[model samples]
Target chain A: MVLTWAVIGKMTQRDPLPDGTMRHSRRRVLRVGALLALGGTVPSLTGCEPFNREPPPPDPLAPMVDEALALAAAYRDAATTHPTLASRLTPITEAHAAHAAELARITKVALPSATPTASTPADSDATLTGLRELERAAGESATQACLAAPAERAALLASIAAARASHLEALQ
Target chain B: MNTRTPGARSAHAAALTAEYAAIWAYGPIGVRLTGPAQEAARDAEATHRRRRDTLVLRLTDAGDSLPADQAGYALPFPVTDEPSALRLAVEVEERTAGFWQAAVAATSGAERERALAALVDCAVRATRWRATAGITPLTTPFPGRTA
Candidate 1:
């Protein structure tokens, strides 16, 4: 009877059982299984922690587009005073709106909630003069953008700069 | 004569056409616009004339047939009122601007820059017209062209 029991034990321990045998061996198997399960869960756990990592900031061009749109709005308001001028300018005004909308879309920015408030220059004539000055500055800024970057950027900035120059001429 | 690309020729032609239209539009634009605005309109006309003259000479030098001035060209519409006149001005600038944009597409280096500058000038004029009309969004998405 004892020989039979020993034979049975040997048969059950086919995978080089440790000295601890039965209980200890089972425990080690469970531990290995647990480790494998843990290993499988690791990638997802790291993925979940993505919020903990820092993200890069948005492109600077986004804000510049917004500013350009705002300036365009100001121009639109001023254009309304002279209907003949306004009619002449309708297409141009429409074009600016389209540009502003496109830039806003590109930058994934919402249209600015507030309209630009014009602090009226002391006199109407003075205001026109001031507007012209502002136009010149805007033209310079647009030209600078072209000078500062890649071909695509340069083209876009150049277009804006030209608009500014046109404004300066009209104001004159 | 040096061989020119189709794009280059097209752009050159477009710029020339714009010059023609600008020269034509100024007559009415100058009349309707008064005071400082009138002086500006006259100056702009003179600028266009100079550009037109330059293009004619350049085309002639290049052995290309230059387009002659027409006795009259149709405006987008009648320029009877100030509003109509301003609108015409905008149309003219935008049309010219589109040509420059085409030029930019055709040429490179200095030529491209010049085309770009011309486009900007048209756009700027459009914006001024917008401002004069009290509209918002002075610079249009596409300045001189439909697309």
Candidate 2:
């Protein structure tokens, strides 16, 4: 229930980060409040009620599904790029895909088509370091989401955050 | 933990039992190890002890009935050797994590934060145990999840 400015502030002024670009592109602002109103990329308080043509109120968890899929796509891309390390990376990639699937199931949102163009470093060691950073940020996001989420969904969100942290340890 | 709902109270009580058992389980875990690994068990046990104390105090202050710590907890499996012992350590952490994870959905405010933190700690410890045991795919996608 508590949306700190730090979590939702940047996301307030702009469109939801475009799909497929969240991993590569710099952090995108989310139109969070607007997103809760659904089907609107623009952040407007006045535009929600359009004379009985009411869109369903969006699940706050929908954004999380997108985040999970983006992470999965990025990991899959890394596995493809580093074929020698595919054995190590593939399980983690599968884990992210599972997370995305579960989040989608909970939110009842279809998984977006993910065309991740993740650029890995030339070396496997550096690539792992990069992945660890991504995992760290994603972990923080999931923890914040857990704190702000409803009681019914908090356990799953907390598990996701803990998993992200543990996954980073494996990367080391 | 002045639990507002029965669900929250039940979850906390269950987590309290886990904290007690985890601390007790570490004795056997720490004994069957050497060097850094033994130190890790000691540290983990100390952490559980601290959390358990806090929970007891909070419940007492609220005039809530405190859950009893058992005289001793049985090991999940034989811990006669290093590999078995390490496996038991992982089991203890993972089992303890389940209660805290459940608590996250039952409680709110600072209690929920504490539960989330405990779950993350257990998951990280479990990962390290798996790595030490040379287990592949060192992390679970959803720690503490039965499904």
Best by DockQ: 2
lDDT of 2 by residue, B27-142 (tens): 88889999988988899999999989988877776667988889999887888988888899898989988999999999888889999999999999999998887777788889
Considering summed lDDT, which 10 consecutive residues are worst modelled in model 1 chain B? B1-10
Single out the weakest 10-residue window by summed lDDT for candidate 1 chain A.
A42-51
Off by over 4 Å in 1: A1-157, A160-172, B1-3, B145-147
Per-residue lDDT of B1-147 in model 1, one digit per residue for the tens? 111666666668768987998898889887988887677677777877887887677667767776667767888789987778778877887788877766765666666666677777677767777677666655555455566
Candidate 2, B21: how far from true, in Å?
A: 0.9
| Every model's TM-score | 0.53, 0.82
What would the per-residue lDDT of candidate 1 be over residues A1-172, giving only the tens digit for each residue?
3433333343334244467444325554454445435555433333222223444455456766666666666556655654444543454455455656766765577777776654433355665676677667766766655555454454555666675576565555
Interface RMSD, candidates in the order listed: 4.9, 0.8
C-alpha positional error of residue B67 in candidate 2 after TM-score superposition, expressed in Å: 1.4
DockQ (C-alpha) of model 2?
Answer: 0.80
